[model samples]
Target: MENTVDQNGLDEAIIVALGCNLSGAYTSREALLEAALEAFSSEGLAVVARSSWWTSAAWPDPAGPAYLNGVAVVQTSLDPAGTLAALHRIEARFGRARGELNASRTLDLDLIAHGRRVISDVVMAPHPRAHERLFVMGPLAEIAPDWRHPVSGETAAYLATAASIGRDARP
Candidate 1:
């Protein structure tokens, strides 16, 4: 994660979700997480809050291995594109190689939300799938329990609980 200061020096905060399932993906699960944190520090991004790593059954394919998930709030001066780029860089640093959608991978970093931006394309704030993912909600609630969806206004904890039940029902 590389940081680029804005000309105005204004800081923008963003929520990020992290996950990993492959063993040899990046040395170890713990090390992969550490590498992420180290990248945040290296980029000079301020860590507002962070949740502990969570282990959950792989979605759509429980037979695969469980995934270690986490969420964090960070303050950066970079814009949405810059922030997204930094996240990709961090994932690449951990040996992540994107393949089939939802397929097991080394490391996964998602730009869950950035302020109140409702963007599309590769950088969608208030991620379209975030409210329905317990893995994201569980960790997010830890750091921002009262957080409401910018679009739906639903609470984080509520979404997390709903996801826990809905996850099993999904085809």
Candidate 2:
């Protein structure tokens, strides 16, 4: 469905995602962002804001190249489940492989938050640990600092601050 926005603000919530690990190739951050924008656009999603790519060293197994991560805000009508499904499809289209947890992937689309709805069942809303991950919060804060977690009652800035503390310590 086509999204609607009033003079006050957007009428629909925005779904955000990050595209990382580009097909085991040396893909630049801009390419990843472009692919994400194209994928979401094809699904009739509107991008309201996006952040520059932030490169980070590999983690855990460190089996692949460093990842270039970033965030994108898109307006959508799909519910959380539907949205996640769409994101998974997009990742598949980009050659994403679902292996071990934290394994290398072609794309990583995380739904940071959806308006004020706090859903937590099969698909948790606001990403259960979004606030605790610097890669997610750092980019999210750039676009939606004032956006608060419906359940935690904490702003993106607060979450980002808390997330930054142990980011470097991640192993």
Candidate 3:
């Protein structure tokens, strides 16, 4: 199981969701995600556990390229905002351009949760809508099945099963 508590008795399960439909400079979405994982370590996020890649047709538009998604449990000393900044930097490094709400991109990295935090200002922890998306919850469940939502108190596995979005997401 992924470590839930660090030596300081603080929750260490920082969750990050990754997805890519456009490969950019990389030859494949899988390679893009792999490079993003490596980028995390340089930003001080230590990956403890990672889920196998999951695939699903693009949401709200199945005509778009299918996406490769996954989740990782990371340990980080940075606060939620810092972690978010790091994720954005990693995304930018991979040619991600923020414009449309759900436009296809070379890479997408979302800070799903920072331990059990529930921050609402600047950067929201326990991302406001992640619980409703199978692309996020399904991969999260694979790595941290027992992880409970800071607000809902529901397990990752339960949320994945009950997710209303990305219903076709699969590993």
* lDDT to native, each model: 0.74, 0.66, 0.87
Residue 162 of model 2 has an lDDT of 87
The top-ranked prediction according to TM-score is 3
TM per candidate: 0.84, 0.81, 0.93
Native-referenced Cα lDDT, model 1: 0.74
The lDDT-based order of candidates, best leading, equals 3, 1, 2
Runs in model 3 with CA error above 4 Å? 1-11
Candidate 2, residue 73: the lDDT equals 70
Q: Best-fitting candidate, measured by lDDT?
A: 3
Would you list the clashing residue pairs of candidate 1? Answer: none
Kindly list the per-residue Cα lDDT of model 2 for residues 149-171, writing each as its tens digit: 67788766688778842264221
Which clashing pairs does model 3 show? none
The CA lDDT at 8 in model 1 is: 32
Rank the candidate models, highest TM-score first.
3, 1, 2
Candidate achieving higher TM-score, 2 or 3: 3
lDDT, candidate 1, 51-89, per-residue tens: 778887888788887788888788888888888888888
